[model samples]
Target: MTQAPPELPLHMRRDHFDPVAELAEVRESEGVRRVTSTFGMPAWLVARHDDVRDVLADATRFSNASQLAFSLPDDPRSAEEKRKALAGQMLATDPPDHTRLRRFLTPEFTVRRMRRLEPRIVEIVDQHLDAMEAAGSPADLVPSFALPIPSLVICELLGVPYADRDEFQHRTARQLDLSIPMPERIALQREGRAYMEKLVAGAKADPGEDMLGMLVREHGADGLSTAEAQDGAAEITDDELAGLASLLLVAGHETTSNMLGLGTLALLRHPDQLALVRDDPDAIVPAVEELMRWLSIVHTGVARTTTQDVEIAGQHIPKGELVLCALPSANRDPSFIDDPDTLDVRRGSMGHIAFGHGVHHCLGAPLARMEMRIAFPALLKRFPDLASALPFDEIPFRAYHFIYGLHSLPVTW
Candidate 1:
């Protein structure tokens, strides 16, 4: 097992809604600096917006499929089995394979497809709001509203039984937590895979209209047409299906839920911006974008490896080196936008790499945007006097997780 590196100040730190002060200093001075990853590997941390964008857009140069292994707990699975398990996750693949998987999944996440989900999404938000209202004030909005709306939506979309949400959600939370022991995290990963396996089996038995079923119908045993096969659609193994479903189930809800929780807290902190979001219907769209950029819930954009020696920000990075882009730092760089630290809902849409940049960008970004656009306004409208139940300083932030967010946002009306 690889030993953990000596503790160092990580660039990914978030002080409530803002990145740690050191991150800003590093961004301004170094731009591109060598840093150690949590997994104990050395990586070049890119902080400038242009440099980060360059690394992300040029996948051929920065390969996402680089085999940098984080220390995992002891498990029975052979190295080959573990590699196979990771194969179906789009984030872990590069180029032709990533392109192929994304091509099959893109239709489900298209703007049109996400738009069709709007009515249902609005209804879901309202239902959660109603429940929150019924529960009265001083509610922990994290579980009450933030987590459930996207969880329910993704569950229905992926054909995961909503009744089993608690189990899967718990597994996801544990898996992403950096504080959790490696063994526990590994166990959670297995548990999640097992749950997904069952869903894959059901999809195989009788394909429903959901995304999982679509995968089965088009690429599984349901059989594809000659044109479908000729177009590069091929039958996916059950393990691959399970891997895909697990990624969708976990990624689909976790990030958005955290955004909902953390974004609300951010708005509460900036009441003036909150007012803009609450009262101005036209501001909602850009508000969501600004919040995504401001909060930068995902601290480290996807990690990549240098495919070849490359120069970034005047620094020479050798081939096969780990590269980690600081999304929060890049988004907050002065070069990216004016007053990058301030959360201005009316700032209009800036080309912020919140959902990331390039081919490996987030697939559920459209759905996430829709959820927030509906959710923030609806929550504010419902509880016109909504404010934090606990003091701002008391709200716990998930600083150690791969995704940055509030652990619980206790609020009152």
Candidate 2:
């Protein structure tokens, strides 16, 4: 007779959501197998690095086209609408459609194009630290620095007004909660999409140099009718456009913010690494990689559905089943990363799953890395004795969410 795996806590139910010891147990466990959850969803948790990479690289059998499977909505009505609405967005499609949707923005987000934001990113980092200094030595860095810096940078790129950020930033946490009722989640998604619709409409009527405006001017409506065009513009429907904008805002803000906060927490916990970077800010470049690897903020990669039946690592996934790539587990794979648990700055993490793998990899990765490369060193250099305001465990870490992070990284120098 065998005992079943323990159930996840309500507060920690987000998939790939982090709980170190538990994750390690599942990650290091043998074979790709079925994990029946209290949520009633039967999922195949791919814990090995090679297996995760295999699943991600082979998309014919597994399609991003089915974003419906990825959605974990607590409400039926909103879930159905959201699941239906996003089918038009890039993340929701496979092949030809995904390629078309992702292609338009790829060139702009390239390494070269992202380089232009470095100066601005650095300036933003300095500004945040300066603001932190002015307020008080011990201040909550999460909102003041971590949140605003990336939020501001992404908003600027999207042509969203700086003034409007406060509202979006305020709503980001609640909107991102997977535990929130499906109706609430659906409403939040609609509000975000609606906001982006207005923004895109404004950009079309009167152009700007931002990504949204460029997208409108450059990519004429691919298949949408005048009615749909009235809805928004170009290759995507209004709902799709809204989904893209909402995704960009949420992705741009949360992931980078968590990396910054959690990365900082990792450093504070490891003094030797802290001293290494404090002496030479240049070390922040590789240091950020190790941080990404060690922090591995996203619990699971994007939810993918099996477009067709597939056998990976000798484990058969029947057609239409849910197969999710685990980011944290992959990053810590022993085959690729030596001493996968230890945080080694010099370790070659170029292939790390921190951003992800294949075409659907994070478009904003370069920007996030740039922000961190600038932000971390600046924070350490500015505050030599930076210390947490509350007891480490007392600080509010994000619970029950895919993006593992702290709610407010309170600190003082």
TM-score: which candidate is best? 1
TM-score of every candidate: 0.94, 0.89
- lDDT by residue (83-180, candidate 1, tens digit) is 75784788887887788778778889999998899999999999999998888887999999999999999999999999998888888988987777
For candidate 1, the 10 contiguous residues with the lowest summed lDDT are 221-230
Per-residue lDDT over 184-251 for candidate 2, one digit per residue giving the tens place of the 0 to 100 score: 65677667667777887787778688887787777745457434433333365545555667778888
Q: Candidate 1 has which clashing residue pairs, if any?
A: none
Model 2 misplaced regions, further than 4 Å = 1-19, 36-39, 67-84, 226-238
